[model samples]
Target: MSSVYILEPPTSGKVLLKTTVGDIDVELWAKETPKTCRNFIQLCLEGYYDNTIFHRVVKGFIAQGGDPNGDGTGGESIYGEPFKDEFHQRLRFTRRGLLAMANGGKDDNGSQFFFTLGATPELQDKHTIFGKITGDTIFNMLKLEDGLIRDERPIYPHKIIKTEVLNNPFADIQPRLRQVEVKEKKKKEKKPGVKNFKLLSFGEEAEEDEEESTRVNEKFVGKGKSTHDVLDDPKLSSKTEDVDEENDDVEEVNPEEQLESIRKKLKREHKKPVPTSTTTAEPIDTYESFLEEERREKKKKQFEEIQKEIQNVKKEYHKNKLKKKEEDIIATEKKVQEDKTIQEYKDEFDKYKNKKDALPKKGAGREQFTLNLLEKFKKKIQSMKDGEENEEDNEEEQAWLKHRLCFQDKNPVLAKDANRKDDDWFEIYDPRNALNKRRRGETVEKFKK
Candidate 1:
């Protein structure tokens, strides 16, 4: 049941206009919006749109056309009744492939409209979109944005050389959160003579036109009588004012002076002063911006300080631990080297010693160690002269060893031990004991001699 403005299966009702870069085929949307579409289609059939150019090109945005003067303000029907706004339920200004009406504000729509060079889905639900461009010239126009003008175009020089509204001139424009210039409602009027809201023109053109002897009196068809031969005068149609936006069949704006007067009313309601900071002590905007900058700088400084502190803590912690470890290692090595007796070696050896079995005993196992066990029996070896050799335990042990060796007491006691338990083995306490023990047979022979 919805009245959608879609192109039929070869998908549209239009003739294709080929360009050097691409083709331009427009599918009209009159089916969805009858009046608005009819107006544009009539103008096309009248040869009114021919030789007009894309007066303004915005990169990544739109390329405006339908201006005979190559200046933005020049398009008007033979008489100047701006077309009534067709708020269609079916069509929208949704994307880049759109061909929509362009207005100064509100009902200011004239013969001039714009075409989207690419997809702009973000523009949906807003502007009074009438149709879409159906051909490849969409691409050709896209490249025009980059030619000499990066983002904005010349409203003066680039004009559409020839135009053919080949088929359906009523197309749907994709819509969106549109700018003030593209809005559907009336805007507050500007302070009279404050700024040029009408079509923008160079001051030089006005001077030259005035100097010409022949005055241009070309009157637009539907608009009221006036001397607006050049077409770019930024005026609105008086007939199109205050029409119900929700209704499809509303009257268009005409009667220029009346439209201008109503605009004056709206202007009074919405007028605003020029934008500037209002601060008693200092400019509010400048001070706020300055404070924000200072806060950022403070944060940066704090971050650097924290980073440096973290590095220093890590370095100091590692340095102290390394220093203490080195000192401890040096001290332990010095202690080991300064030890006199090979105490470490002896201690290791004695760890498994069977002390009861290794103690010196008399006769068979004992005295060859030459430790003089008699002295150790009770620590009686007080001096080398009156030592334990003269003690009773020493004399007895020495007698027992001599009986075995068959040596007289006059012979130096090579070794001696206490006459003790039979289970113990004699352990050598003196270095000489080892040599004498090994030379047991020789020692006996020498003693006999």
Candidate 2:
């Protein structure tokens, strides 16, 4: 399929796009992406891109358009469906003013296309490049008023007013075949070895040093200039001529004129008046000076005393700060200890209460039998309490167990009333659970604990 549609390019082919900003001339790469060029040309000829907008315009990036829907969502080809991408190595998007197709994914080119504003090497081999923008229309478009550009979408609407093929001069030019990028061979790593030293003959060393000196001199003095080259330069030669003329025009002075000038200098010196020295008196000391000196000494001694006081104050403040911190630490320790003790008491209480509740109620058959059973139960409870005390001492437990054998539930039912008060055996705290109690004509408390 690729061999059947090889590009037979012309000398040159260009498309003139008249946009709202300016007219952009694009040179089509017929020899590179022949199918893309054909698709673009067919669309232009059919007037399919006349009113489309350049919906996507990213500054310093790309200006995309050619969607019939004007929002980059719609495009159609002369042949139904979409066409495959025609990529060529020479047709890369590595410079400004690049023309290429816009597709949803690989090889989905239709009528949509884009022109790059600068080099986009990252898009290489990703999009088909069938043409390149020419002329200064791109620069003009950049200068256009940007009403609003959000998310790279041109909200102001730079529509394609018109599109036409200006020229197609590549009718006979065939596209050079695409070439694959070849990987270069890696350099071999150098092995460890003794450094090689070359011996130079005495004569060779001298010659090399001489050559190096000559090169150094050339670098500093630059290339030697010919007579003609010097003469050709107006600024340098003119300045030299002016200097020579000035030297030649100098006049000579006579010895008698020099003597007369020296004598005149001596006479002028003698005629000048001599300046007199005026004496200045030293400053006299007064009684006020002594008093001022004494006052300054007193103030200096006072400042020293004040500095000592400030030092004492800072020391006192530091001591107070340390004392307060120590107090806070002691308080925090006491609070943590109290909380631990309270938590331990609560846990022990809950354990003891559960054990007491689990004990069997007084069995009803005979008073003597019940009394004997109660006595045995009391002894077992006492033994368990003694065992716990021996394992861990608890003041609260000792007080609680003192009345444990005598304590009883407030709603306890007698053996005779057990059958008749069966409905009241269990405490119902919630109102919903009181339905049965109400039906049985039994009184219910707001709370049962």
Candidate 3:
């Protein structure tokens, strides 16, 4: 008796995805795909996947989500950029409820993830399988799959409400929260006319204006002096009267001339020598200079090595591409040769048919011609069958031959006609049935049912 082997889910890390439809419990395969698992765990803890809808859901394939944009275009890994895929030999999309990362291309793994609806052999090596549904969560996956519409999307908005980390293997590791700096709004400066509106009233506007004038006069005269005392000073009064008389005697100068004078004064001031200061220069550090030079040399050598590697890769790629082209050419040549041989047989048959029409109705010559034609056809078919047998080891050749034979069988000339039911030539040499029988190790005899 053989003992049954059961694989247990890992307890190292687990997460519960609470969604609009149902909750899904996932067991992370941390040991096999650590990077993918860690990335998913961090994104979940950071609430990056929260409230994100399943943007793409294909029935019987996968349920993709984790894109913040609600479309399939947005979302990034916890590393803040696309990360490389972590494909483990043991992990694969061999069953329903498997968790994997959805990528746009190679090494383009981001925050987007998907749940397999069934065994997806086509996606085995393409995606990184990091986790699997545990317990009765397969029911939730089924519900999700069933909700998909014709457009490969859920009819309703199916979103992940929140993610709860059950057990984290890297407990010490915390998510790198993005810091958004808020800009403060600046206060607007009030205009001088608007600022003084409160100081003046409708009724006492004149009195306030007078008081403001006296305050300005006292401020310039002296801090402790009143407007009356400043006006009572004889020397200040005489100076003010003389300045007013001089301004009245002087003619108003042209605004343009005043600006030109100011420009000249500024130019003269600018022409004056600028004061220079002297300071001691700090000595250069020889050790730091040496280290920098060595670092540059190392970078140059690394760059050169990378260039050489790129060249080698290009050479190998070109070589493989050329070899593939040569193989394709050889295959095409063989197909052309086979087509030419078939066309030659057809031309010969046409010639024989034309000759029979020209010959007598009841004669030995016509009968002999018909027999010869049938024998030639039989010989040609036998040779083709022998070729198929010789190339039985080559699957590609067999597939090509099978495809060609099926195409010929579908031709109007070879296909059975309802009007003329007596034609049994195609039945005896039916390549489709013969190929199937040969694959099953059955002996194929010429002109035998």
Using TM-score as the measure, the top candidate is 3
User: What's model 2's lDDT at 135?
Assistant: 70
For every model shown, what is its TM-score relative to the native structure?
A: 0.32, 0.35, 0.39
lDDT of 1 by residue, 114-171 (tens): 7776556555543457666655556665655655653366534354444455655345
Indicate the TM-score of model 2: 0.35
Residue 103 miss distance in model 2 (angstroms): 0.9
Runs of candidate 3 with Cα error greater than 4 angstroms are 1-11, 180-449
RMSD of each: 36.9, 28.6, 30.9
Backbone collisions counted per model: 49, 8, 0
Pick the winner on lDDT between candidates 2 and 3: 3
User: Which residue pairs overlap in candidate 2's backbone?
Assistant: 9-170, 10-169, 10-170, 10-171, 11-169, 11-170, 12-169, 12-170
Cα TM-score of candidate 3:
0.39
- Count: clashes, candidate 2: 8
Instruction: Tell me the deviation in Å of residue 202 in model 2.
Output: 99
Best by lDDT: 3
Question: What is the C-alpha lDDT profile of model 2 across 335-413, one tens digit per residue?
Answer: 9999999999999889889977866666563566668878866765786666532435356546756654443448967
> What residue runs in model 1 are displaced by over 4 Å at the alpha carbon?
1-22, 118-126, 155-158, 168-449
Q: lDDT rank, highest first?
A: 3, 2, 1
Worst 10 residues of 2 by lDDT: 2-11
